[model samples]
Target: MQVILCEDIDKIGVAGETKSVSEGFARNFLLPKGLAYPATPGNLKKWESEKHLREIKLVKNLESARTLAAQLESVALSVPARAGREGQLFGSITTAAVAEALLGKGFSVDRKTIDISAPIKTLGAHEVTIRLHSQVEARLKVEVVSS
Candidate 1:
C-alpha cells in the first residue's frame, strides 16, 4: 500500500514522505494511529497546494524579519543595573533583561531570540546578536550602566 506520512514514524518515514508499506501495516498501524493517509490524487494535490502556500508565508515572514533587523540596528539599548565598587554588574545582563529593555524601548522581542555566547557580567557597550529568523539576524548595541 502507498501511504503519505502525516507525521514522523520511527524506522518508517518522516512527515510529507511518500512510502510503500504492507497493506496490513498501513491499515492496522499507520492508518489507525493517524500517522499517514492513502496516497490518493486529491491528497497529493492538496499537499502540494498547502506546501506552496506555506512557502509564500515563510517568504513573507523572512521579509518581516529583515525589516525588523534594519530598524533594530540604529536603536541602542541602555540597561540599568546595580553594580559593586567596580563597574562589574552585581549579577549579569541576561537575555531576558535585554529583551525587557527592548520592550521598554517600544521594540518587542523574545528573550529566547536574543543570542548571547556569555552573560554580560561587566558594564560597558556590548554588541548583542538578536536572531529574528533562522536566516535573519540583527546586531544590537547594549550599554550597561550602574543604576
Candidate 2:
C-alpha cells in the first residue's frame, strides 16, 4: 500500500515523504496511529503545498537566528560584584544573572540558553557563549567589575 507519512518514523521514512508499505502495516498500524495517510491524489497535492510552506518557514528562522548572532557580537555587557584586594569575587556570576543583564539591555534571553561552562568567580572579562539556536552561537563579553 502506498502512503504519505505525516510524521517521521524511525527506520522507516520522514514526514512529508511517500512510502510503500505492506497492506497490513498501512491499514492496521499507520492509518490507525495517524502517522500516515493514504497517498491519494488529493492528499499528495495538500502535502506538497504544506511541505513547501514548511521549507520557507525554516529558511526564515535560520535568517533570523543569523541576524541575532551578528547583533549579539556587538553587544557589551557588564556585571558588578564585590571583589577582594587580589580581585577574586565574593560571589559568582551565573547564567540567570547574564540573562537578567541582557534583559536590562533590551534583549530578552532565557537563562538556559546562556551556556556557562563554569561559575564565574573572578573580577575580569569573561567569555560567555549564548546558544541562540542549534545553528547559531554568539560569543558574549561579560566584564566583572568591583561593586
Highest lDDT against the true fold, candidate: 1
Candidate 1 Cα errors over 4 Å, as ranges: 1-45
Per-candidate TM equals 0.70, 0.66
What range of 10 consecutive residues in model 2 has the weakest lDDT sum? 6-15
- For candidate 2, the C-alpha RMSD (Å) to the true structure equals 7.4
The residue-by-residue lDDT of candidate 1 on 1-147, one tens digit each, is 999987656689766789999999999999999998899999988877787776777789889999999999989889999998888888999999999999998999999889887789898999899988767889999999999
Q: lDDT at 18 for candidate 2? A: 94
lDDT per residue, candidate 2, 6-114, as tens digits? 8767678877889999999999999999999999999999988798787787679778988988887789899888999999988799999899988888888889889
TM-score for candidate 2, please give it. 0.66
Which has the greatest TM-score?
1
